[model samples]
Target: MKTPACRIFLFPAMVCFSIIFLLSCTGQKIVSLKTLLMGMTDRTGITQTPSPWYKLIQASSYDRKSDKVGGKGWFANDDYTQFSGVDSSKGRKEYILLDSDGPGAIVRWWMTFAGEGSYDGIIRVYIDNTETPVLQENALKLLSGQLLAGEPLSASVSPETDLKMRGHNLYFPIPFLKHCRVTIECDSIRITANSRKPSIYYNICYRQYEKGTKVVSFSKDELLQNAELIKSTNETLKSSGTISDNLNLYSSSEPISAKDSINVNIRSKNSAISKITLKLSAFDTEYALRSTVLKITFDGFQTVWIPVGDFFGTGYKKTTSSTWNSRVDDQLKMESYWMMPFKKSCSVWLINYGDQIVKADLNIESSKYKWRSNSMYFGASWHEYHQIMTAGAESEGGTGKHRDINFADIKGKGVYAGDAVAVFNTVEAWWGEGDEKIFVDGEPFPSSIGTGTEDYYGYAWSRPEIFSHPFIAQPSGSGNFHAGLTINMRYRSLDAIPFMSSISSNIELWHWLPAIINYSLTSYWYVIPPYEINIK
Candidate 1:
């Protein structure tokens, strides 16, 4: 009995409704930085679903397990898998950087050549186990964020170019449905350096999806299609458009005496915190900032306990600068952009353990959130040691028993986001040789083990230079000898580590000199509520 006009309108309506229903049934949408930030806010407030759920993972060229502080007997065997030299006879073809089977995406890549003759190397990328490489090109051009004829891909390349050193970084997202294999042929390559020999230093940062995740394999055509989108997103980021829509809640805390703390409670249903910033002024700003502790509880459970400076990616009492998820300015202002979701209520406080009265300025912003059962509350923990000694085969205690500094130990389902570390070196002969071991879901051995401390922070050769990326930064470095402080931070976007039951993240305190070194770290993660966190 419907009119002909009704059919015209009803047909389109039915198609639109069906499309929306299908999308809703398909679960979370896979979004990149560009898609996530587009129209995320309105006149009323920010949107409910700006960020999609994803966990970050890193695959690097760490030396070997035997190099661990406590390996003994069979465990001390050498395992050199990161890079290889040019086979004089066959050349360095098929030099694999990453080989994994998954529904995942490679989010970032970095590489640097040691010695000489590496710029002319060829890079090959094979996706889904295809017999032929999906991409084959010059290593120098590809890593330097350029296409044919040196056209810059600013969205991808974030590098360090000094007179003595050159490092390449790439950030193009390469999604795969099945398998990913990357290799480099270094034989034909030639570096500008005067040396005759050359080696490779590289890092592969990616995100592993759930078993049933549907992903589109990356292709050259797809990259071209996303070219304009990527450029637009980069422009938005450069102009600081993504965060302009947030509602900032800022307050200066009442003067608190020594050993006293002040609490700020915010109650709202279906809301998520987007950012937090703080600055302090005191008689002894350095000691007071170090002594002050920040505690945050959400939905009736305590989640964060860290020093004010460490929580914001700085070593207390030191002048530092970095640009990432967290940053500390020269004027001592600290800022963080870790998104935190809460359904009911949240409480935060700062306790001054120092002697003088400490004045604090705080700002927190919240946005509309529709938290699901799988959504987890954000958590952070801090740990430090005044002096940790290096380990040798016969030195200190047993090798494996030499306690690795614990970044986090959690029970229940969660994702490890990232961390900031403050290294106070007493003797500065490369204190970052230690490896990272991340054990997930009750695994006896760490599932994600790193090559070196510097490598884990997206750099090479333990250089003392400042470099910042969207996800990682070395804000402060040991300048002259090794007597100063070095603070490093890494924030994960598409590469967060996920665990179903439990996870324990530790970094080997393998220093260079026998002298004691100070190590402090603040670990960040997200977990289902009603869980326990142990940090030592």
Candidate 2:
């Protein structure tokens, strides 16, 4: 929600004092590497390092030239027409931006639509520069009594709001940011149903709004790291005798053409694989598989099998080439992440129940594990991500088996478990795409993090795959309003696609299955260029 800043002006006085921040390194500074990593990685403030950094800016209201065209949105609401609300919440529109106010930066932001709005929908944003005015605009909507699982029970402004349907939310124009703040204003709210679970939809966007300057929505270095994350994950899965969930493959015995798949038949009498899941190796990599699915014909019934999207919070989707859904066997319920490589791997799993899988096909594509924002988005030093990558519990989602992983427990942890660790001159998520990979020594970091659909990525954006941006995030601290429990203040995602129109169906439009493994963002980190900090 906030951005980091670099020291604005140079202070020669810092040179006289051995303030660690002032200098790169000492000739012989004595400090434990782990301790140094811990200290240096504490990104809990605005300008941890110094000037020439970036931050996120929110908006209250603003206007677009009736004749300008820079970016566009798909919400399909008239609310985005103008930035009004000069004073009254009647016509003014609000916008927000996530940028350094560089050239060509724009933002498209909206609030959580829970199908109930008796008043102005709430808008709370993370701000970097408090001095800047937050753009405020009055966006409005009418709610219709309706409900969607995982979404608010009410529906609106979709399929063209009318007497039969409703306008559920006031879609704000995308915000523009030079500096940031969030603006909220609405009136006359109504609710027809309860949102079964907290939706992860905090829809916002970042674009270059100014001329000549392309506000990097995300750190370029970080994006690269994210891209490389895929290869790192691929290697880990391959080494562990597992397959990357993004990879689609067929039995080595069969040849696969571009986007080709074979029939997997399950006969009534055959001993079909009721369930199959690939346990990811976590000792080396921290990628968690989500939204596991299956496709097969069992008992004369053929259908794509899909599980609840948050099944333990981890499953894969057709990221690149393969698209998958699940087929259910009421009598036999099996769920697993089986290996489906894109190319010729030696073998594959089979569920032989009178059904002959003429071909065991796999879908190989890039799906992402999206995290909201690391304490910041881009790349981090090996020192960063130590706590997040390690296991622990989310205040709201509960804790998991935080298996302390390192070289010490290598043997006991697993055979392929890595031996030694080192710093990589290269980062894991070197791609803006947010795909990053870790490195053990100079090789691919030998690790994987797997959560059953029941765990990690289970709660919408709360899952590690789609919106677990911790480097730029922190534990959602507690507030007096809600005691005994804490929600992650940093994690964010939009309510899954709202009814584009009344014509949209949950099954057909929203893909409401709680089992789609939305995304799995991976990045690599290594202990290189040793550095330390005094986190007071």
Candidate 3:
């Protein structure tokens, strides 16, 4: 089926119904499964501060002993087989993965297991302190599109990766009003530190809304009620190609010499750039891809500055890949669908810093936009750490010097949309065993901590295989366990982190071998003006 002229076309009806449904109850801030589903496709919704404000948090199987910064066990690598708590009161052992109270929703869930019978467990989700579970099924089957949702909504990564090593993910939001508890019941499961037999790893990203917010708790009947909407949402997410037909097209093909630049200006008020397409050719394609930079200014604010290849998720090489927001075809035609709204005018520039003259074709599509007070400007920042050395953790029998590498530090009110990392390893050992730590609103500790780098990118076990989903993708993984380049990225919709004041994102450079590597990071976000980024 062809996609709707506009995905947000369905947003109004769903949101109106949700408001009425909430009014029928307590007339409070309404948060229901329908609203959350609608939010999944509403790209503009993320730019504004979320109404009925909430905090995005994560529940993971990280080593519990790693509690303090620069403290003992801080770099511990026993990240598997850990649980929040275990329950054995009801005749069977139920290992608790996540337990939270009050109004909230589980935006994303990711899990991967090792050893025999690890995936045979029964996963159950209890809502609102219910004695019974709203969902009870085999953990792997329920998470990997065999139950509840399908395809992009619930899937395992990299069909090329071994089935047992793939990461299983579920993006379907699960909301609760009073409480929520997720557990797995498996007789073969063991809760020992660093246990390899039937080892289980998980990361659950959820939202905790403010008090007095009304939320319709998730139930099996809710899934049945919204089956058709769910199917439509899945279809909308999987839709590819151009975004809309009503956009004004602007194109240019010019050769950019060394130290020269080309600019495309859209002199319009109340407009948004809906899509951007570009292609480059040169004798040294890889060098051109790295040295040719793309910059954009929205309403006079320079909000984007990055190498074209990394910005398009191709890294420094032309690799074929696709995601919800970006794509690179077999012919190396790169495209981005990020909505960039501007007030008066916008400027896009391609700057060539390499010695070779690069031939370029750039196309941008803009549409009429109704910019409101809450509308924001899209921004991207990029940086690279060349030949950085890693100190292998004690688990690998080396000096434990694992530390956080800042991806982006923004001082402003905005939402963190997503990020991508490209790495060049110099050894044949695993290089991404580290986890992600995200701090928002000047929090003393990170609000969102992940299990591992690959896990944070919607995969597991550092499997060197290519995969693509609507929100996450690994275009190249040759460097995961060997000496080469690897690219991994994750985009957010409902899982987008909004910060009122500031946000800092970091990832640990915990390689298994004490070797030198090159790492580059590109971060995507949207913010109101008066913002400052530490990328330069």
Q: What TM-score would every model get versus the actual structure?
A: 0.81, 0.24, 0.94
On TM-score, the leading prediction is 3
Better of 2 and 3 by TM-score: 3
lDDT of 3 by residue, 1-536 (tens): 33122111112445545755667677565788888998888766765678888889999988877788667866677788788888888988999999999799999999999877887788888888878777877888779855778888999998887878899999999998899999988878865444545789999999999998888777655676689889998898997654564689899899999999999999988888888999999998889889999999998999999999999999998788888889999888999989899989999999999998999999999988888888899999999999998887566775778888989999999999999999999988899988898999999878888789999999989998899899999999999888999999999878899898999999989998888889999999999889889997
* Candidate 1 colliding pairs, count: 12
The CA lDDT at 244 in model 2 is 32
Kindly list the per-residue Cα lDDT of model 1 for residues 1-536, writing each as its tens digit. Answer: 22121011011434434544565577856433233223221211111211343445666655543443355521321212354332233343566678778777787676766555556567777788776667777665566545521222222222443522544666556777689877777654443433224566677777677676655566554455456666664453333112635464746557878999988888989777777878888988888778999998888888899988888876675565544356677788887766777889998899998889998888777777777757788888998887777553334333433347888789987877788789888764666756678887776656566656776776666777776656666777773137888887776554567777788888877654565778888898888855778873
Q: Is candidate 1 or candidate 3 better by lDDT?
A: 3
Give the local distance difference test score of model 1.
0.65
Candidate 1 vs 3: which has more TM-score: 3
Query: How should the candidates be ordered by TM-score, best one leading?
Result: 3, 1, 2
Clashing pairs in 3: none
Measured with C-alpha atoms, the lDDT of residue 61 in candidate 3 is 86
Candidate 1: deviation at residue 59, Å?
A: 3.4
After superposing candidate 3 on the true structure, give the runs of residues whose Cα lies further than 4 Å from its correct spot.
Answer: 1-29, 192-197, 394-397
Poorest 10 consecutive residues by lDDT, candidate 2: 500-509
Judge candidate 3 against the unseen true structure and give its global Cα lDDT, from 0 to 1. 0.87
Badly placed stretches (over 4 Å) of model 1 are 1-57, 64-70, 73-92, 148-167, 188-197, 236-250, 318-324, 392-403, 479-481
